[model samples]
Target: MNRLVPLAVVLGLTTASCSGGHGAGSFLPSGAPGAGSAAPASAGARTTRSTAVAAPPAGWATTATQAVSLKSATDLGALDATKPVTVRLGLQLHNVDQLKSAVQSRAVLSPGQIQSAYAPTASEVAQVTNYLQSQGLTSIAAEPNGLMVSATGSAAQIAKAFDTTLHAFTVNGVSAYANTAPAYVPTALNGIVVAVLGLNNVQAFATSPHRGGQAVNHASPADSAPAPQPESPCALSSVFIVGLPSPQPIPTPEAYTTGCPRNYTPSDYWRAYDVGSTSGAGRTPIAIMAEGNVSSSIADFRVNEQGDGLPEVPVVVKQVGVASPDTAGADEWTLDMTASTGMARRVSTIYLYATTSMTDSDIALMYNRWVTDDLAPIGNSSFGGCEAFPYLDGSMLVDDEIMLMGAAQGQTMFASTGDTGSFCSVGNPNGVPGGAPLVEYPAASPYVVAVGGTTLWSQYDGTYAGESAWNAGGGGLSQFEYSPFWQSGIQPVGTTATGQSFRGTPDIAMDGDLQTGMIVYIASAGGWTTIGGTSLSSPLAAGVWARMLQNHPGLGFAAPQLYHTFAMSNPGTKLLGPPPTINVGPFHDVVSGSNGAFAATPGYDYTTGLGSLDVAALNAVIGQ
Candidate 1:
């Protein structure tokens, strides 16, 4: 596809989906409460239990989400009647099915080949523009492929053009306006305009925030110990980092029985994962999707990169609307930047798309820009929408269309599965016992590769031990989406009590346990904070893809190939049940603990998905 953005960047559930769900599973937030440990309520709406049990009053889209009990952040935001609102017009492309077929075949595609095979025809773009004009919309700018058209209109004008209502809602101290009702397009643009965006801004998302910057205990707090700290400044080695708090009065070896040290850096991860030599090396420009500025953090990143003997990488920060630094924004950006660069050592550029807010509308626009930007081939999204949130509930179709567009252009988006384990629909800080499960979207989206987490057990000398499913990694079946054909071969296994044959999450996992977390510079946490969560996993995996692409240039989207290759090269190891001490070529079969509901079994399970990465082995399979 034609690279559009140049080197410059730009850049929930809960709402039951409109898609069909087999009765095999109930998409409720039951079972156990999530970790239930309080997170710094993500910047926009704080996710709360579903209060709107009653259906929409009248004349609402049948698929409209449960009415949320908003706390009105009137001080922070307001809906202005005359202010022109920019709504992205999603046009349905004509040969998308063909594109899917091609993707399934894993056929190598060149930029020109991908564009010619999947881009919307000029006629389709023109039709959408003309139809929007007829509805009195203004400031129409059609994106390159013509599948996206941005138009401006007043609230009244937008209401008249699309059947929807605008209203403001608030949660936690953040607020934004949204289309309270599900919106629709005119018959003139019915098939042409697949979906309209920027309608609702209710649902919000975040990087599954690192609460209090503490590591979660695997067995009990006594099983492992915190990392040793340096009391005297000179005691710290030249390469050794020193931001850790004084070690516990009697530092104990914490984390897995592997006795891995707590203090780690980008280089440590490089050596441990055996990806030290696999570098993006000034070729691939990775795209990190989040919000806020990280000028200082970028400087720190450069220092760390050079410290590791990797070339300095230029970071390009681009804004979607009007994004600013929020509470944990600095830390989020820092970790994402450094870790991704650490893996893809020679990556030329890192494009950070700072969206104005976590509002659903802005997020939709965020993905649209990422895909349509066309500069970055690989993307990393650390945040996720609550399944039942109205914003996400409404934009599912529009979002899917955007993902497919990216896929057609050889773009692959890696999203964080979530931090809340089996109880994805609900917040699980306490790591409670039972709660109905829900999967986070964008990750749950079939087109993207959902990255989960693992409790890495690599030691100081790079000695590898077995990894287990993170107590907090998100997984289970997608309530709305059906299983993708590529992964359909694996039998769906959810919590031990139940199983659903739907789209299961976390195509793969990587180190994310706070105990074994990657070391990152978190300004808000007073310098270096050991951070974990799928937030780390997503970018880590994105970097891996950048590496894979650097070597295997024409590799198709990762989801299909992961399964196809795994099935072909599965060592058929019978670690538990019987004899074969077989070796899984591409995967490191993780069979240990459970996420909450599901146990990490011999084969594919909800937690740890297809296990952690074996870079050398992975390259062998995917590079084919």
Candidate 2:
């Protein structure tokens, strides 16, 4: 009966002492050397891992003498040996270098060209599976791609196999188990193994939608505004249907617009981008992979689809693994699904994949299932975390490998850069003093197209005025990853600004400001909120790609072709085709605003990347 409880919990309104988070596991710098320098062996495991999880040496064991102590806020009491738990073991992919070479080579690929060349070889799978069997951990299930192996066993057995002590720990203010020391694997699976996961449930990955704007539950003085109430329940059809705090328990995708902010709807975005009418239906399916449930908003989705003028497309919901069926954050998931379907209305279908939890392994496994299952040709992952932590330590983000496979098999991935402006690490939940600013992961991976954010300040009359970089649009230099040859147009970040530069985000930007954000039905937020963030850009882009693929049959991995022409230019020169001075090409050229320290420059800057899109223009120039 207390309104405050639901609001506080639903809105992430908890202090360190209460909510579960990456607390107690914050990164502490012990002065590690840069790449190419003599760093600790563990610290020197060079790859894209260096830029993200291993930042400023994150929490990984940098020295032989320096054992990584995954400290706990509480003693966690003791671990029960009899209790069974699931642990994830990671494996390295085959032909990693070759895959990178293909992506950076700036070659337009044919469908199934790259995937045919790169895959987890049988040797690698045998090497991992053989080792796991040797550990007496027989309950093993290899992922569809064979990049990972999941097994279940008692706490004691799992701990011993991982060469660590299992300790009861808490994260996000919830009780869980974790490893107290750096987990050790056998020599057979050492280098071939990127990292292990599921050892600690405490630091399991948690993701937030990139949407910007304050979310309020119940009633605040701000909710009383009557300027933008919907005329009917289905009036705001393209809106997201979210769930509110507990006790309202109906789990209905209801819409109420009496007390919501005014913002652009999916229809508005369609009009803004001039998403030309295309009867080219049955092109590609847009699969949205996220945590939590999707069944809650199916009814509302049809309403939005009809209202948006999108042809009736089959909408399907499937589970990656055995995730919880409980209705939690249902509305957030609905937002992504509806937004994507609304944007690329001609798609063949929409597949929603959910994992048991947002843990690192769960997220990765779900993605593995989606890709391996060949669920769709286009993928949208709008989840990421602050790049300052060792998200790659126990469980390495094998996302790049998976993404490469996707690209090879005619799939293009679009991920949100982040929503924390330039300083994506500013408010790390770990509560540690993060050394410097950075962008979020998956976006940092060169294989995935990092979609950034922007604010469209124009008339709501569906006419364009001008645009600027969104203040909260995430962008910055990757501390570890170097820019590929395709991305050589941007200046590298090392001392020389030479060929040795860090990869920049994002490759593109779109409408992502609360004022000019997406207006979706949020069954949770009472009705609608002007939502904007790199999250919105990613799915929207995926939708656009779907539309393009309809006309162009084999537009596999568009980034390479994109960079070879429009986005890439000489180091100090303006892009050749799309003049930076005008708005005539694929991009709108967001030449204003800043995301923390980085400003949107004349051409491409970290803030808005190459800028918003002219969908028709982009698809035309992509391959030819």
Candidate 3:
């Protein structure tokens, strides 16, 4: 297992220890109540409870917001009261228990059906909207499902309205703002309002792509020209293999040496994973959760498709919030689109849900749009933060609700478990070892499929040789979320700080080592580059899932089905060995390598959860 670096060694902090859970200095105000704590009453059951507003003399009783945490933040000072702020009032879902049951039963419901049965009532939406309007907030809009109400107001107005004070802080070098005290809601809206988001402006999501080397500007003919190819597979084997110790020299495939720094092409992935001829034809659309303007990324994708001799998939960009010209994440978005389509070969439509930023609030809105649009049965989120961050800020709660809705509608979301090893990145993008072991959010959420990473070893012809868990692949038990019902019997025995069996990530993995990364076109970056991380793994999973949906359009909530399929195929939970000879079910169960605190075991280890995919095999039995 990889070891953690001391906090002082990693962050140069004088602090001797790091706290991973909510403590006395938590953002939630003292004695604040009304947060969901109890797990599902039974297998696949969801329970909803309202916070009782505290009775105060001659004033409206208030309850603390359930989703608010200030775990790793350092307070700077109070924000100027005149500063403007925007927040989303997350409304409670109606009939959540029924929704959970419907999803667990694998009943495929349409978006309309889900909304009709589980969306919050119109009155609930109005109650929150009216309250926000009365508080002098503007630009208020409630999502179609009435689960999230967004509004903008002055910091002073917000503080007065929510009974909390906004304060500035430096969270891991990012300038941010958060509520110094727990946000409160009137007693009247006890169950109507679940969370107050955007009170904190810390960016909770980061792109998971990891670059192998500096990209060349493909604008020049010399740069665009292909480099000399390796003479033979033996010659290619000289290149250092990632995640393996030196002197453990393994046979590297010629395909891996085709690009500078060794990047694999879409064709290579198709062959390696035995995708066969499945191209997601006649499949429901796929969605990519992205931020900012992605026009350049889309253009780059077209260039790649043309070069690969693949048909250009129809693309749609849905702006989820205030539009911004930021293309900072263009490469990440491009990777997601290209890698997914590259896997499927052909897709009906690719919807990009572009939000204004990666903030928790915007990301939540982006997810809400995808759930509501119902344009795609499979969606990919190539970005995530440490699970604790989202859990504290309430995005986990709000987004989980949105994902649950997607699950009920037969929509599946695939999220990267993160590029960090077993530990989450703290003030460092590459991840700091020696920090508390934590999983990435959204992936940690039981509602979505967590895609991990692996160092794939393929033959010269792209046939699968074997694979090991990528050293940097994100996996481990979640610190907060309880193990979902589907994971009851399969997840490794482990309890969270709350003493509940927490969820384990990731449910699946794909080629993600930077050494064997995907070759993608990034217009903003001026050309082709090799990138990996769970970011690529997730979209790859999504694309493969799209193919499965093409074969079995009625499939619902992939996690449960995947687990059930694995159990059926590998009866008695047999320990699987390395591939090529082992006929391990639908997945190529990885039995070697480790990712920090966890090692790749025969079955369901934290490092490479459920191993990587055997696309053709999975498609054959996914819905069975």
Candidate 1, after superposition: displacement of residue 432 in Å? 21
Model 1 segments more than 4 A misplaced: 1-80, 110-117, 170-174, 211-245, 249-261, 276-280, 306-309, 322-328, 390-393, 425-436, 494-500, 572-583
Model 3 alpha-carbon drift over 4 Å, by segment: 1-33, 36-76, 169-175, 207-209, 214-231, 234-262, 427-436, 495-500, 524-526, 571-582
Assess each prediction's global lDDT (C-alpha) against the native: 0.59, 0.56, 0.69
User: Which ten-residue region of model 1 has the weakest summed lDDT?
Assistant: 1-10
Give the TM-score of each candidate: 0.78, 0.77, 0.83
lDDT of each residue in 1-624, candidate 3, tens digit only: 111121211322222121223222222222233332321111111111112334432334433343233446676777888889989887667666667778777788887777777778888788889999998999999888887889999999998888877888665676767776657777777656667888877555544335644453222222233322334442112121222122122354344443222346676678778988664574568898888889988988888786555777899999888898977678788888888888887789999889998787888898988988877889998877675455544566678888888888888999888777887765542221244466777788888999999987665444676777889898998755666666767776675434446688999899898777776666554456667888889988988887888887789789888877777776225433233223468788787788988988777889888778888888787776
Model 1, global lDDT: 0.59
What TM-score does structure 2 among the candidates reach? 0.77
Report the alpha-carbon TM-score of model 1 versus the true structure.
Answer: 0.78
Top candidate by lDDT = 3
**In terms of TM-score, which candidate is strongest?**
3
Flag the better candidate by lDDT, 1 or 3. Answer: 3
lDDT of 1 by residue, 99-192 (tens): 6676677664565675565655687788878877987988888876665788889977886676666665554554556665555554444345
